[model samples]
Target: MTDKSIYRIVFHNQGNIYELYAREISQSAMYAFVEVSDIIFGERSKVVVDPSDEKLKAEFSGVKRTYVPLHAVVRIDEVEKEGRAKILPGGEQKGNVAAFPMPLKPPID
Candidate 1:
C-alpha cells in the first residue's frame, strides 16, 4: 500500500486501550505496528483527510488486526513518505527502519 493509504489505529482491547500507526500493506493488508502516544479522542469516532495538513491518524479494534471500513477514515491523502519508497501504517516503509530515514513521498498522481 502507499503511505497515504495508512493512518494511526486506535481501539480498545480487553477494556485496556492501545494505539498504533498501521501502514496499509495493500488495500487489504497493513504493516509497521508503532505504538501511539498522545492521542486525541472525541465523541466523534471519525476524521476527514486534510490535503493541506500533513498529519495522519490511525484506528484500531481490540478484537482484531482490523475493523471498521478504511473508508470511514477521514484523512486518506497524507501518506508515509519513507525515502524512495512508501509504506502503509500497519506496515513499515521501505528500508531498514532501525536507521530511521526520513519518509519520502510516494508517487501519487
Candidate 2:
C-alpha cells in the first residue's frame, strides 16, 4: 500500500453513525475487533467550526488506537483522500442498510 493511502471507516456506535478517516487499519489481536490507527481530520479554519467535527475530535483526542466490533462496522473503504470526520444520526433509516442488533448489556453469570 502507498503512504498516501487513506481509509474511510463507517460504523455504528451508541446509536450514532461515525464516519472516520485513517491511514492504518487491520484486524485487531483481540477477537472480533478491527484495529484502527493514525486518524486524520480535516484542517480547521477560524472562520467556521462544525459542531459534529468538534465533537468527534474531542471524543477521539489522545486516542492512539481504537478497537471496533466486527458487527458494528457498517463498511470500510479506501478512498483517494481523507474527508471530514463527523458523526451522523443513526436513528434515521434512510437507506435499506441497517445496523446489526447487539445486546446493550452482557448477560449476568
Model 1: residue 58 alpha-carbon error in angstroms: 20
- Candidate 2 overall lDDT versus native: 0.87
| All candidates: TM-score | 0.24, 0.84
Q: Residues 1-109, candidate 2, lDDT per residue (tens digit)? A: 5678999999988878899999999999999999999999878765788899899999999999999998889899999988889898766567787546732543579
* Runs in model 1 lying further than 4 Å from the true structure: 25-109
Q: What is the per-residue lDDT of model 1 for residues 19-45, given as tens digits with 9 covering 90 to 100?
A: 334444224433333233232232233
lDDT of each: 0.34, 0.87
Runs with alpha carbons beyond 4 Å of true place in candidate 2: 92-109
Judge candidate 2 at residue 25 and give its lDDT: 92
